[model samples]
Target: TYAETKFIEAEAEFLVANSGSFQATGANAAAYEAYLEGIRANMDKLGVSQADRDAYLSDPNVAVGTANLTMELIMKEKYKALFLNPETFNDLRRYNFDDTIFRGLELPEDHNSVLNGQWIQRAVYPSSEFSRNEDQVRQAEKAIDQPMWFYN
Candidate 1:
């Protein structure tokens, strides 16, 4: 069981490494490197063999590029790592789909239509419930068509 968990952790680390160059700036690089180090250290603490780490690191199909690594690539790797996880759905919703990568085509002209612009910023409260809680519901509804305060 320990070995299996280690292998999965190693795979996640390999993904972060493969997805980008090491020269990230701002908090992005710091956060990613911290995560990578945590995974690798955990494996070491768990006594995972160097051979296992090498096996994952050496995989040929893993994309490793020093110059072309980017946030987009990291996100793609993250998406793969999150397979079957509930957070994957949230990730999909938050990361606007890049039609070229997701569908192999550009967005249709209708994408710009008012009805298809950005998604509704929030959901409307049920009418019956809103009627019962008039003042509180009205305040909450103010955020429906706009980004939440945190997002703003």
Candidate 2:
């Protein structure tokens, strides 16, 4: 939970720090540091080795404040650190699944239903809900592929 807070704070700091170029600046290094701190916190929780953590942080791709550091890099780290956590989808949605921001993330070759050639922005309410609260549920566009209320 603290990591989540830190990550959010990092994002805020990043937004303020890089208001134009959207690149890391020396003055913006605090957000960059906070971002790395988030990853370190997750590593600490997962019992990752100090050596491995050092190695990971050393890699140019994973290093903070380098040219390689961008919104995608931050989100990708968050994705890895929060794997299987529901908040993962929140991150995806907040960024609108922009391929530029989530590089290397490809939709499945054999697409699943309800998400044909598109991001499954939101799932339709459960079928049971449709029956139990047809009027209320029907108000929500009635499409499984529809984006959620906030997305609209």
Clashes of 2: 0
Candidate 2 stretches greater than 4 Å from native: 20-27, 66-68, 113-116, 149-152
lDDT of 1 at 117: 60
Best by lDDT: 2
What C-alpha lDDT values do all the predictions have? Answer: 0.45, 0.71
Give TM per candidate.
0.38, 0.77
lDDT of 1 at 28: 34
Q: What would the per-residue lDDT of candidate 2 be over residues 1-152, giving only the tens digit for each residue?
A: 66776677677777676773334443267678878888888888888999998888787767755334577667777787778998888777766677776887788887776566887776557789877988987776556556554531
Please list all clashing residue pairs in model 2, or write none if there are none: none
lDDT of 1 by residue, 35-135 (tens): 34433454566577989855654454333433333334344444444446665444334434444223342445565354356644445688897769988
